[model samples]
Target: MLPQERQKEILKLLQEYRSMKINELSKQLNVTRETIRKDLYEMEDKGLIKKVHGGAILNKANSETNYDHRKYTNYIEKKSIAKKAAELVEDGDTIYIDYGTTALLFAKELMSKSDLTVITNSLPIANELVNYTDFQVVVIGGTIRKNEKSLFGPVANLGMEHLYVDSGFFGMGAISSEAGYTNFHMGESEVSRRMIKHSNKTVVIADFSKFNTVAMNKVASVDDVDVLITDENTNQEALKELESIRTRIVVAEIVEDEKSVE
Candidate 1:
């Protein structure tokens, strides 16, 4: 078969199922694994797909923005929350960062801290701390969730059991008086639950928008969270309600940008 035809077939298969391994493609296409690998690499460079550890997945950028997009969604708010959350960390502390956009910001904030052990299921968070020699980074092994670019499943939960930390910073999809804290993805939620159980203290970092929105799974309750960090945009009424439940709330002051006034 012609190379172009083979590539087209591969694209068709990926479109149907979203992802496929090189070995699977080889068997399906009656091609050698090396040939399929080369084709996948070429497709990845062309922006036709994304290459995973053992396979290729249809690019989900248009449907779901990757970590970079999420990291910048509420840039100012996230930065403020991260900054405040960082103050809770002391030198030589062990921390478990859950996989979420907000937790990714927390990892960035921790980049300057020295002599800390960081455990996480977030690839982006782990990569951010890679250059910091003083910080020890450990990643949990599990089934990688393509949309979120994080690890989940039993393996990841098992990896988390090996260590207890001073604090665990988590991000929630929604926070409400009724539902408490929830997540959109079930696999991710399971990992978050494990992290909360393994930590001495649990801090939840969320933006103002997350209030009142409930997702698929509930990770914890208002009582489970030791501290709640958010930006100034958070509603005063919600803050009062949170405090009533004995959840300490910290609102980060926003720094206005003067250049926009011109």
Candidate 2:
């Protein structure tokens, strides 16, 4: 990888792990300890990471933006993940769509399907799916998280009671072997837990960036998910972690648009 590309991967790792030893980064990125040290030095000079005694930690100043802002960050990758996830849905199936940018894209991917029921707390997802004549969109009501534009709380929890689905599709803040599946928002995590409880199958749709990361609130264990759909760029170690737990990993290939053959 180019120096810049390697540094970007290092930043992503630090963001997920919070901190890392030089040797750890070297192993994960398949580089030498000296190269990791040099990358840390450059990243520190750029104010993206802080070089510690033997490694580096992400600079809080370089953290991600709000929910709406993140929707555009990894557009193509998320779309590809969403598309692959949508394929798992058969017509006439009932499924729960969790609240997140990727979940919203998954909702859009389902627009062409017929006779489906979508359960969601995300206003964007419900609004998008409701337009489809063949879809039955169920909105879980609760206190609104304005920034995320999703609902979660006791009322939403109550809404989940006695309701069940064939499958539950979720988007997580992060996933790792040690941390399992987690979310940054506690309320959303609870909602995800309840959805997983009521569904026959659980599918997590997350981009490669979410792999190997741990978030603030626990949602589910790695083995709790039946299938995980991610883009091709997911880290090898993270994939191995999922494999160890027996969570089915589906890597979505990013297909490029075909050019004119002439």
Candidate 3:
């Protein structure tokens, strides 16, 4: 990878793990330790991370952690879920997309659609659709979250009032029968609640990892959502629990999307 691209990956790892050894980073990045050290030096100079004895940690200037949303553990499953979720959006439908990694993938899937309105608080998601003339992209106004490339606060909610969303597709940290929907960040939870209120149908695009794992902030419960899109690898017990909640569960086939491979 290029120097710039490699550094970005380093930063993302630091953000997720908080700190990692030079050796570990080299192993993960598949680069020489000297190269990793040079990248770390550059990141330290930029104030993005602080170099410690053997590794680096995120700059603690801010209280909240802003992790960049990217492809995660369940790559194939999330891609399948995202592709299936895209089908739920018909022509000319206005949808509210969350600022989650899966939601970003779903936004990319919508690129082929010629007539659609997408309202989002995610800067990355908005950027994905910004150049597409066929998409009417409305990025909500709010306090900018630099790390996650998302928006939050009251203004984001105010904008949602004028929007009548056909569907609100969200990515949550966890979805439990008890806790409902939960997110890692409190600000994201606030934005999701507003989207859910404005949406006629609320759809949560999640991999099985989210099931039964509750995060810090609760977004909503299975009772509030209209559909749950997940992969087949999810445990039968978890699926049974969802069925008991009476939520419409849509299992996305876990085959690789040919479009992605192409």
Candidate 4:
């Protein structure tokens, strides 16, 4: 098969199996192991797959996309994660919600609570919670990112200095045993880092798609996170890594209906 055809086939297989060893891919495609390795490297460069030790894994939803695209990419999984994360909040809690679609969904999940003091850098989350009237929404003042509706930079970092929160919830682009927690945007990751530093407890809200992946910006280590809420679809290998680090994991059961969220 041509190189493009082989890459396409590899993507299809990864999508089907989620991940595959390089030798297995070579045998399956009747290609040399070196050819498989080259294809995997190129695919990883394009953000299509993540190359892991001895293997490559499907990573279609992990690429950085615009807000609307990400908001709907893993809708059900985000809902489940948001619901599970919301369970940790109390009516009078003071919390920090960072920028991202999952974080926005998490803000929505907090509508049931009363007297929440929510500090955030996400315009969507701030707007979503503001209408409720009972919650006090504080937007982290910083340079605004146009399309993504987020704020960051030194100003935002300075804003986090004087404030302390009961808990801080963040969405990550990727997480791994080695990288800990990372995201695509440096500014956003810095804000998350500050929030984590200032909060008493840090909670990471992410779906299974983010597991075992590494992104550009470092947020915090697994040890910094007090709780991690993810969907049940997360793989065992990834879960075991988090377990080995002694990270508290909450597997949010995926409810097919929105009854729980509503």
Number of the top lDDT candidate: 4
lDDT of 3 by residue, 133-224 (tens): 98899998898877678899888878777887899999887767766787755577898988898899999999887776655456887789
Instruction: List candidate 1 stretches off by more than 4 Å.
Output: 1-66, 257-262
Q: Where's the lowest-lDDT run of ten residues in candidate 4?
A: 58-67
Q: Which of candidates 3 and 4 is the stronger one according to TM-score?
A: 4
- Worst 10-residue stretch by lDDT in candidate 3? 61-70
**Model 1 RMSD vs true structure:** 12.3
User: What is the alpha-carbon lDDT for the whole of candidate 4?
Assistant: 0.86
- Cα error, residue 25 of model 3, in Å, equals 32
RMSD to true structure for each model, in Å: 12.3, 10.3, 11.7, 8.6
Spell out the clash pairs found in candidate 4: none
Candidate-wise lDDT, in order = 0.82, 0.85, 0.81, 0.86
TM-score of each: 0.73, 0.75, 0.72, 0.76
lDDT-sorted candidate list, best first:
4, 2, 1, 3
lDDT of 2 by residue, 115-182 (tens): 99889999989888776888888998999999799999999999989789999999988787877887
